[model samples]
Target: MAGGGGGGRSLEETPTWAVAVVCFVLVAISIVIEHIIHLIGKWLKSKNKSALYESLEKIKAELMLLGFISLLLTVGQSPISNICVSEKIGNSWHPCSKQKEEDAIKGEEIPDDSSEQHRRRLLMEAAGGSVRRMLAAGGEDKCAAKGKVPFVSADGIHQLHIFIFVLAVFHVLYCISTLALGRAKMRSWKSWENETKTAEYQFAHDPERFRFTRETSFGRRHLSFWTKNPVLLWIVCFFRQFVRSVPKVDYLTLRHGFIAAHLAPQSHQKFDFRNYIKRSLEEDFKVVVGISPPIWFLAVLFLLFNTHGWYSYLWLPFIPLIVILLVGTKLQVIITKMGLRISERGEVVKGVPVVQLGDHLFWFNRPRLILFLINFVLFQNAFQLAFFAWTWYEFGLKSCYHDHTEDIVIRITMGVLIQILCSYVTLPLYALVTQVIN
Candidate 1:
């Protein structure tokens, strides 16, 4: 089969080995960067800068993953573009034609009447019979006659790869440096837990320290003014409260709470932190094992539907997955609420320690759950791309002769834009809803 047309330009092929080598190099560099960040964290710890160290670690973890994702997007573009513009004809695959004129110029042998009719029948079936009307519409087919490919050319793709690579590198460096500089300037802003007094008390005792004045740095003068202004201060307070109203599950906070509850049983008993942590981890591992089967089953089911030309019915598989996540979230919330109640009463519930019960909750299995969520997101993205490619091949390519290239391009563009919007906007909104529900 032939590839999409740009003066007979074939699909830009990337060697499998080259892609593998690039991925390996990216992983190696990420590992090195992480090690450097770890060393900086240790130095911060020695300087008693616990807040800054934790922030650094968090930044490192997030930026490293984002950098890897950016690199993967750059490296995978060519291969994904090739898949988008190619079609399978019978047992063989060929590049799609950009224009009907190119098909005539290629001087391909004409099939017998019956064979030609069969091919037309196949094309019509593939296109769900939409091609006939598209062909009959003369002036409306001008956009299709242009035969523009769905995405950019090879050179443009290469330039995009370079741009993404540079942007990823710059983003990582800029964020890390900004965090370090900001933390350095706020050296006295220790973690709340480490302070001997409350934030309000500290502010009341030394208002000058917290106040913004003419001597304040240029970057912070506006922030100082906002704090000094009555209206702006109310707005800031409202915004802060609004942000705090959002539910957030912090793993470290949960773990520390569990540990404190467990150790509260004996005031004089020597607490073995390492042993307790090890036991908690073992229990959490068992919970993860117990939950793995259903998650894996749903994933496999989705994969089957996705690969078997059941694109239209793909949403069916996600139903069970969503149900599982919701049920798990509810169970987690119930367990946490119960634990908090027991802690507040200072009594054991049914002789089960809060720590032991917490270990079995979804909160402890968060890392595994996050991993699964990432996999699900990747699968969703793959499904979106596959569905788009299938539609382009079946609908767009079949109607190519009708000069419907503009329609094809528009459909492809819309599909891509929707995929991005769903990934970033829709998915996050869904997650927020789930969080709110929990």
Candidate 2:
């Protein structure tokens, strides 16, 4: 099949499913063959020129041949449309080429024939091959030309090809970010234990003892006590469950505010801006925006399961960027408010607003704004890339959008259902896993 021949055709016409099945079978066969060859190779290693060695050598070569064949087949099935086909020249072709060179001739006016179809396929294949070859050959001109190949209006498969290209580009970016950020460094199951231990340590060892000399009737009433110190209310209510189990301390009189304070000094050193930012990012990574990891993980599972289906897989690219933007905006608003407060204090010079870290007030001035803008732009770009990929894929699969309305509804509903399930599962699991793991 070439150009529009493959587009909008039935699954049977392309037999893509059959191709996939063949690939799977070949892989399985190759695995079995490799194992057999490995055993024979090992057995032959003990004897240099024995009969066993000769037999094993033949088997090894066969296995290698099969492996190479399997790899080529798999690559052919890949969305990357790169393959070379050479055309046979004829006397009529020379006259047609001369006419085409002197004056552009309309291709569609030519009668459809076996020879024409063959030529078209060869030209399309050559285009694909040249695009890839240009990439391999280093130069700015080559790369610029290669960039334009996916969008050639002459090719009927241009839409499908470009959609895949955009997806491949986003996938590469995703892999790079994931590697750099180490987002999955720890499993979510261990969160509770680490958080509990940290809470316990802070409750026991806070250095600042804000003494209240006025021991009045307000103290006796208990209402004046916790109400006067909302910080005390948060600790006694939330932080005390784990703290009570750790060391010898009275819950009512244990005046350590740093136990539950966000800005408390972490072990080994007093808290600083760098460490604060590090811990903040760490917590963010561990947390799923609305719920727990298992649920979000399940949502991811659903997306992956539907990835091969047309239109169904269209939304896959957009989700990551959406999540990032949502989370990042939430964080920015929080930091902006905090920065405002820090700026008001005027004690610590420089940084964002209300938050004070050690000797400096967090400044919400020009420099911080510039930095936030840069971060926001990066986050927005990632989201847009994902969104564009999904929309572009959708556009390619259906010229008549009305035809796929039902499919669209079904996919959206499934996505929502999975995301809701994840939201429900993640919170409790996060608490449980954190307790157990670290």
Candidate 3:
């Protein structure tokens, strides 16, 4: 009945091209934010000059990106207002769009002899078509009520936007605080490294001070001996686990043991720690880039569906979250496989073989399992895209006056639910299929 709520501007007054422009601007802003965070990380690495600092920078950047994405998905769209008609029948309120479709199904028809009635019917039909077009284009719609029913309100939508904005702001601040603490920890680690080197030198040059004598009393041998040599005391305090595992405690044994425990791979060696850290950061960045498109598509679809008044499918908003989980799981499997390959090549970290950790069932120890997960991820992505297209075609293009809409929605929802359930039950399903093939 009334116009849309942005400064009394009607939905029809907003050009469809403006929606495309807004989407473009939002995407540009997201890219700029990501680049700025990356530059900040580079600058922090230059200033701190520590691998730990670089790691912290990656974490801060990821946290900020996640917060920004959450805000964009939740509150980036135009506020909802006066977009649809809602009728209050008794105490329950429902969209008049549904009511109109129900009346049409009951064989309501315009009188052919009444010119005024025919004109009004034509106007209503045109208005309905325009509303559908706007929704399909990812824009809002406004409908003129034929009855005394009011336009749908926007107060709740505004409240939700404000709440999500506040949470996003808090998330950003939390990430900043964590970076500050991480910087402090980095400084402490640097000091500890220096002290460890100095202690090792002292222990090497003055081994007699750390050794025990045959005539020494028990109290002096245990307490006074280590207390007198602060280097030994510090080494014991820091490398207590290594000390416990050592078979014998002597100058050469303790010196070699400490060296083996503390020293990382040499920079010139094949598996450089710094390069490994950089590669890990790069892999994380690649994952973020890979996942952004699907999330953006899902957000646009959500806006379109919300404008079309598809409240029965509220679970649509969570699809992006599920997609993210699946992507992460697939990445984990990939990383584990890579780690296994490196381990097979005899790569070592800190004198111990590198081994990736994962659940035995899901870990890809064989080529067949790797291929299965790869195909599974591709199939899931294709299925989701197909499902979205089908829903959009059936509900957006075709009018909802037919009874088939309910049946279609139900069938599609069930299929999606089953597919998601199978994704989680992947290990069991894969084992079952393998046994059948055998």
Candidate 4:
């Protein structure tokens, strides 16, 4: 797909429609692929059944589903951008193009004072400023912007409140599901351990009461099970620690650790095998970088409180903050888990080489950190470049000059400098803070 292009050369420049098309096509392709996989799996079972083959079928199903959703978002980016801009424009009136053009011609004739342009700008900013202040003061839930009605109903006055309610519901569901599963596994393991101990006691203290004989064949399998299931034991230990053993700050790390361990295959020997790799990556990232709904809350707060001279620009700062925090948190979660040997291989038992907390700071363990940081920085810069350029081209430069510019140097230079400072300087500093704080 063609990239979303620079500031307003054409409506096509944004690729809004193209993005929608791509998203639709991706979803269709994914559905077709899913059906094909199911058909192939059925054919395999008819030809020759194997437990391994069945497992492969299941893994493939999961991986393709994940890829489908990921690509769906990639193509849906334009819609996301549209939503941002549309929300900003709200419902306020803009001057007719004819009137604007006449005004521009008259202003050019006078050229001494550009007061008309200044009034238009000041009016827009004033309206925007009031909206921002209201939002900041807990009036966001009841914003009175004259632009588009934010809520579906004309009478609605709680758009922000509705957004929060929906988001809180989803977050609560995810946390409950993960923790509940963890607790269930712990209970199962404890029950099994208790039964084993009871059997052992019967054999020792009441030899005549219970007949027991050890079998060599089963011993080999039990040893294998022991190696694989120690991670289960680790799960119990970690869950206990999480609920009762650790401080709140450390819980995020431990939560991620538990997730990584849980995601690791039960069959340790082939844990890193290709069939499982996709799952491992997805689950790992979800724990690491997934944004909480609260981020929007912060975004709203930024927009509301900082409405002074281009103060709405303050909200722009938080975009990088949110992105970096997500990335840094993900990195820390993955690094912490990998160091603990909580990868596809389940968990490490005694003597199995695993990086400790201190060992993780080494460059050797964190080559990915550098790569991720570089890519993240570049991507942020690119986004700012595209977004600001689009906005400026749409309304600023053309409107100022009636679509003509004898010297665009100042405008272009200022735009580039703003992009540079916002993307490179401000974003990287915020990321550093996230790394240290997280």
Candidate 5:
């Protein structure tokens, strides 16, 4: 695909429709490749009856479905662009014609396509036109004036902006909606966990305890026994966590939550992994809720600064502050855990002995391993944060023009990235550091 282009001449000279075409083609080609992969996997499954073939079949089915969605988006880009620019000149915008200095010097009037002419002149300058060519053009300034040079390389980018902004807005909405749904799901899981725990605890004391229990009546009315069977729920819970753990955070303890809860009982049948997953989801959901507000706040801050001039760079200190604070929360969690580990000197909490604290921490050997993990993570986060700061400085503070020269989506995307960096990367790192140092 063609590059998005940079500097004054990049976006300015490229025709608007040209960009849409390249993007559409790129998506189409990717879908075709994925479809081929899916077909091969299906063929392999038909020829082989191995476990690996079964997994490949599942993977192929998923890839084919995803390819269909990818194709839809690629095919939709042009219509979206056309819809955006339809009211204004009908999406027929083109680059300016190459301006001829000789014609201008001969008292000739510029044509309607003078913009296209001027871009050709600029392209020549970009191509390193010699002094003789420059001199023949009667100086670059006069040529530029004839071309009606734009501050933003206004060539074709102005029209493209509408479509880019539209997608950015869509992404923002998609993210927020998912977050809301996730939180709601967490609440449901927590409520279910509490009821399950109460029922199991009551039944644990007596074999026939659940026969006349309130939970039996409630469970029957809400869901059949088969629906909530320990085996089926375990499959769904483990699979959901596995899916989430792959691309999302909490890779380690998220899965271990179920294991820890399971192993606490002497036998596997004595503990339910489904209930454990419910408990884990309930807690993990809180972390997501806690991290989301500040990310959105920062995103909005970036959107505002997106339109601002270089004066906005004065607020650079704020970025590091955000990073530090994010790291600090993790530190707080680590520190509290560490303190609990050491406080087992027969100290009493409310009426419980401090020795019980270790039992409450996540997973086996966490007290020994977690502190080391936190420190290493902190160092890495500190390094990555500094690196991000340097790149941000180069991309924004040191760039071409100070005004709204770049697209809003670029800034919006950058802002969203920073939030990810802070929440997922740096914050966890520093939290570890803070836990150790404090």
Candidate 6:
């Protein structure tokens, strides 16, 4: 895409091989890296101390969710590409207005020498109908060249190179540095054991720490409908088995104590970060971070290679972003409702269990910290939704983008709602569906 080949072609016109290959390669790389991580973990298990592995594992799940989001953005958005031609992967991604504005300034073919024309363009964009009116204005003006497509600097070679080089450097350095810590005497398994014991002792003395257990699931009211669907539970139970096959890859930050309490075996649950992070090296807690870089690399390749078929699914990567948003929002719901469930007897509460909680599933059991995370995820979700909504209004509905399907605001809105519903309600909805089928 960088040189002369893909410069003028639309996304639909491009071949799928480039993007598909990129995706494949990145995924392969991720698999390889994870294998290396596993080997390191295995080696640590032999070493008996594994202090370095413990440290890396502690940061793994945090890296997973955060890195996954970053990977999504990295691959889906042509961070390196100008806005006009930035489309790459993912289902829910959309070009931000700021990026588009920059692209317009850099890629604009029409001479903007006239002050009058520039002023008029600014006003139209601010008023929210920039495209249609601008096209109309371009029609009346001699310089507009009505039928000619606007020029764009579609070459993203520099952007891709810089991003890849910098990320690779950081990635290499970070990996090496963490591995180097393994050589030191401090981070060994013994050190981790001591830290875990200390943390456990502190948590036991703190009466407020009980909230970080499994009781923070969705309330009975939100899940009232799923109680009747036994078959749906069966399906989820079966699905869990398949997922558990690769449990090591499933670890992620979303499993704060609340999520963990519901996802792991209730009998042996622990709510300490210190314990869980080390356990993550041995289990499913590090999946997200392990896979993020490879996915991101593939996304970058999608852009750098100038892959075709970006518009094929109206941005498939965007869907995952929203799903991630839904999961985070659902957690906020749990935290908000968690307060109402506490009683005179203590942290006993009722809710739907998504999965069994892991020992040390939470980052920490401190009430203040938990409260802060809840607030943080809430504000973050709100900002993302706002941005998505704005982009939908500004660009999605506008006629300028390729294809009528993507341009249909009504359909896009409904699709988004449906996606959100599927994210949070799929298991229960499956149960409801199975009841009817049975």
Instruction: Give the candidate number with the greatest TM-score.
Output: 1
TM-score of each model, paired residue for residue: 0.30, 0.25, 0.28, 0.26, 0.29, 0.26
Give the lDDT of residue 125 in candidate 4: 27
Q: Can you write out model 2's per-residue Cα lDDT over 1-438, one digit (the tens) per residue? A: 324323354567768878899899989987896697677667757644243344345434433543454455444432333322232221111212333322222233233673644444323323322222222112232223434333222242343344434543443353234323332322332342244346565453333433231221112222234533545543443332222221222111111122223334343123222222234333332221111244435444533344222443355434433443333333323222333343344433321111222212113432233223323323233333543445435332231221355545544454343333222222222221122112
Better of 2 and 5 by lDDT: 5
Tens-digit lDDT track for model 6 on 1-438?
Answer: 222213345658868997689889999998998898788778877877555566457555544654665565455443332233212221123222433444444434224574544433332322211232233212331112342212221122323333433444333343343223322311332443343346563454243433422333333322333323655433333344223211211121122333334445331234443344334322321221133444545444433322223452354434444543333333333322332333222434323222222213223533223223322322222222333344343333441232355435433563444333322223122211112112
Candidate number with the higher TM-score (3 or 4)? 3
Model 5 C-alpha lDDT per residue in residues 200-292, reported as the tens digit of each score = 633543332323221322222223343336465334433332232122112111222233333552332345433443333333322332213
Where does candidate 3 clash, by residue pair? none
Ranking by TM-score: 1, 5, 3, 4, 6, 2
RMSD of each: 17.0, 20.7, 18.2, 19.4, 18.5, 17.4
Q: After superposition, how far is residue 436 of candidate 5 from its true place, in Å?
A: 19
Badly placed stretches (over 4 Å) of model 3 are 1-152, 156-164, 199-438
Alpha-carbon lDDT of model 2: 0.34
Question: lDDT of each model, Cα atoms only?
Answer: 0.37, 0.34, 0.37, 0.35, 0.35, 0.35
- Candidate 3 minimal-lDDT segment of 10 residues: 244-253
The 10-residue segment with the lowest total lDDT in model 1: 86-95
Error of 2 at 226 (Å): 38
Which pairs clash in the backbone of model 4?
A: 90-147, 90-148, 91-146, 91-147, 91-148, 92-147
How would you encode candidate 4's per-residue C-alpha lDDT over 368-410 as one tens digit per residue?
Answer: 4543443343333333333334335333654432233522443
